[model samples]
Target: MIELEGLTKRYGEKVAVNHLTFTVRPGVVTGFLGPNGAGKSTTMRMLLGLDHPTAGDVRIDGRHYEQIRHPLKYIGALLDAKAMHGGRSAFNHLLCLAQSNGIPKSRVAEVLDTVGLTAVARKKAKGFSLGMGQRLGIAGALLGDPQILMFDEPVNGLDPEGIHWIRNLMKGLAAQGRTVFVSSHLMSEMALTADHLVVIGQGRLLADTSMADFIRENSRSYVRLRSPQQERLRDVLGQAGVPAVEAGSGILEVDGARSELIGELAAEHHLVLHELSPQQASLEEAFMQLTAESVEYHAHSDTGPPDTNGWAGGTGTEAVSGGGWGEQWAREQRKRKAGG
Candidate 1:
């Protein structure tokens, strides 16, 4: 297990990681989540002893990174997939790491095979594709058969098959009772891989919980119903004291209700139910809802950037945000459908 006690870091006058305290237990994949410049990389650097903490303590498997004997054998990490020397071959690259850590040379080949880089063991690192580089990095991390593994965006530049391979590899590691902590921006992939999560923002901790609980707390849950008789269904639901919003295309969305309740109501009203399903929010939606305020960078919509200076021959009104944006988009779609 990895333990942090009041973990903190500073760069000059800026605080990168605040007084954060958390424990990453074994037997599960823990996802570290944060927006850009949220100090996730800094935190990981501190964990590996690459950066000294200003005022705090972090331990990897009951000991500090520098204090551990043969550190790679205890904890292995892949912070940057392309950090290797381009002049060296894939086998030489992993062999160098193994040699430094006092790991057997035979273990190097085992890891190369484990990451599916055995075929290209003699290939130069510079000639390797992004996916191959990522695999080589993973191979180095596995060279010592460490009990703890950490990866930062392990699936970067990987195709669908490579992504699938890495996903199962991490899962398999955790299944063997290893501590796996990974940092990734891909919420969809994290949703499938991680059982627990630690979310941070602006160098401060936001949440540390299970994937299911995080989504449950940060996102809204509603029941979606589709029926041919939407008008009658709306009236029936209104009389039944259940407020439902029309969600376009004969669909009604009801909040604070369950599928069983809606199904019973529909049957009693003699309304023909085409579809009735509970809509639990997705991980992306939940992550956005929780970190919307902490986001340091915001991109413009495809409509274009904000019109700061008045432009010649331009409409006076600009599209609104939030609900207004969607409303305006719907208006534009209607106009197009009418050939305006």
Candidate 2:
């Protein structure tokens, strides 16, 4: 299990990560989501001991990451798929990690086969494609057969088949009571893979809840009705004290009413209905609804051509600059260099 208590990170005047506190328990895939510049990458860096937090604490299995003798055996992470020596072969890469962490050399081949990269194990890292690099990174993460795994944008360069494989792989690991924490911007894939969600915005925690509850609470749910007898249906719903708004194309949408209830009402009124379906908001819609204000970048639609500022039909500071999040990182790096 991974636990964070009052975790915070600050670089000069900017708060990269606020006091975030959440528990990523075993036996389920907990998805991490946030808008651009929301401090997601910073938080992950701190969790893996890649960066020091300015305040608070984080632990893996009741111990700090630095204190663990063999961290790979306890918690494995894939923060950056391309973070490897380009000249090294995939097999050598995994072998080196295994050697340092006291993992068996034979386990290298097992993970290579597990990620379907056995054929390319002898190839140099620079020669591999993005998807192949992703598989190699995953193989390294599984080298120690750790109980907890964390992946960030694992499907960034994967094809459909690779995506499906990784999705099921994470589920299979969690089924064995392993803790799986993943961060991704692909809401559709996340909706399919994650059982729970941890959302943050502008370095602050916005939500930590089950997937179903998060969507239901943040989005509108309604029943869509389509009928040939539109007028009769509207009258029936009105008389029954259920408000329905017309949605063109001979369709009516009723809020706070179940499909079964509406179907029974139509039946009692002797009305002919063509469609009666419950419409729940999708995960993407729910995410937008919750983080609308927290969005750091904005794109505007206009009839004119794009402006020199790179933002379409807009000018001034309000326009989204190219250096959105990178500006913050550049400042942080400069501060570090000066302090050093």
Candidate 3:
């Protein structure tokens, strides 16, 4: 288990991590998520003692990492895949680490096989591709066979097959009662792999909860309806105290209203229903919504506003524009104050 108590890090005048406190228990895969510059990497660095925290403490299995005797035997981490010496062969790299940590050389081949890098164990790491480099990193982390593993963006730059492999490996490790904590920007992948989520924004804790609870709390459920008499339907829904927004021509998105009620309303109004479907916000959307202002970077399309044109036809788009609970609440408040 890993526990962080009021962990904080600051660089000059800017605070990178602010009094962050959380516990990662064993036998579960916990996902760490945040936007760029939200201090995720900083927090991970502090945990591994790569960077010193200005305040607070981090404990691994009831002991600080710096205080642990033979620390590799209890905790393992993959901070950077490219941190290895490029000239060293895969086998040599693992051998050096094992030797320094008092690990037997036999375990080197074992970990190489585990990461499926045995074929290229003799090859120089400089010749490895991005995916291969990641595998090598994972092998090094597993060399100690530690009970606690932390991987930061493990699936970045990986192909679909490699991504799936990493996902399964994390789950398998957690199944064996190991504490598996990974950080990633891919919410879709996290949704499939993580049982718990720890979200942060602007160096502050936004949420720490189970995956199901986080989704249920942050996501908004609504029904999209399209009818010939769109204005009439809007008026009817408004009169019924149902919040709605006109979503382009002949389409309306109704919130806090059930599909059954929508059907009954349509029937009573004799409206020509062209389309009606329920929509649930995705994890990616919730993440964006929660950290909109905390996003250090924003990508703008060349054409214009994103909603103007369906470049690839709605199939490739993500739900909720990175605005999570905080943004959603702020938007609601603004609307209410404006008499929306």
Candidate 4:
């Protein structure tokens, strides 16, 4: 289990993380969510003892990261895929980590095969693609067979098959009562993988709740009804004190009403209903609504309608982020390369 209590970090005048208090219990995949530059990377760095927090406490299990004799065996993390030495072979890389962490040398082969990197075990790290590097990083994380696993953008460069494998892998690990905490920009993937969510904005705790509860509370829910007897259905609903707005195409949307109740009412009125379904917003939609105010970066589309000629207009299309931690990190890397 991972615990954070009043955790805070600052850089000069800018607060990167602030007063975060939460417990990531075992047996669930807890998702960490935030907008661009909302201090997610910073928080993860603190958890690994890579960066010092200005205040409060963060622990792996019941002790600090450094206090653990074999930290990797207790908690394995994949923070940056490019963290390995480019000069070393994949096998050599894992061998070195295992040697230092008291892990068995045979475990390196097991993890390499686990990540499907056994074929490229002797290949130089520099020659690997981004996806291959990600796999290697994951293999290193699994080298210790830790009970607690933390991943940030594990699917950044993976193919669909790899994504599916990792998703099931995390679930399998959690099924064995392991603590899995993952951070990803892929909301669709997160929605499928995470059982709970921990959302933060501007370094402050925004929400920590179950996945179903988070979406239901942050997004709109309604019932859509369609019937052959539209007029009679409207009349019955009106008389029954259930206000439903016409959504065109013979569809009626009722807010704050259950589909079962609507179906029962229609049945009582002997209405021939074609459709009665409950509509709830997705995880991405709910996330946008909850963090609408907290989003530090915004993307603007073309002022005019989309070009119907199969071409994009405006200067160019940009992703919905500018100052996100990943972008900033890339910028720093470029600066360092230029300086070198």
Question: Sorted by TM-score, highest first, which candidate order results?
Answer: 1, 2, 4, 3
TM-score of 2: 0.84
lDDT, candidate 1, 160-234, per-residue tens: 999999999999999999999999866788999999999876577878999889988877789999999999988
What TM-score should be assigned to candidate 3? 0.81
Error of 1 at 243 (Å): 0.9
Q: Over the stretch 226-335, how does candidate 2's per-residue lDDT look in tens digits?
A: 99898889888899888899978878999864789899999998998889999986787677656543323321321222222221112233223233323344444656
Point out the worst 10-residue segment of candidate 3 by lDDT.
Answer: 304-313
Better of 2 and 4 by TM-score: 2
The candidate, 2 or 3, that scores higher on TM-score is: 2
Q: Identify the runs in model 2 with alpha carbons over 4 angstroms from their true place.
A: 293-340
lDDT of each: 0.81, 0.83, 0.82, 0.82
Candidate rank order under lDDT: 2, 4, 3, 1
On a 0 to 100 scale, what is the lDDT of residue 217 in model 4?
A: 86
- Model 4 CA deviation exceeding 4 Å by range: 228-232, 248-250, 268-270, 293-340
lDDT accuracy of residue 296 in candidate 4: 37
Superposition error at 294 for model 1 (Å): 5.7
TM-scores of the candidates in the order shown: 0.85, 0.84, 0.81, 0.81
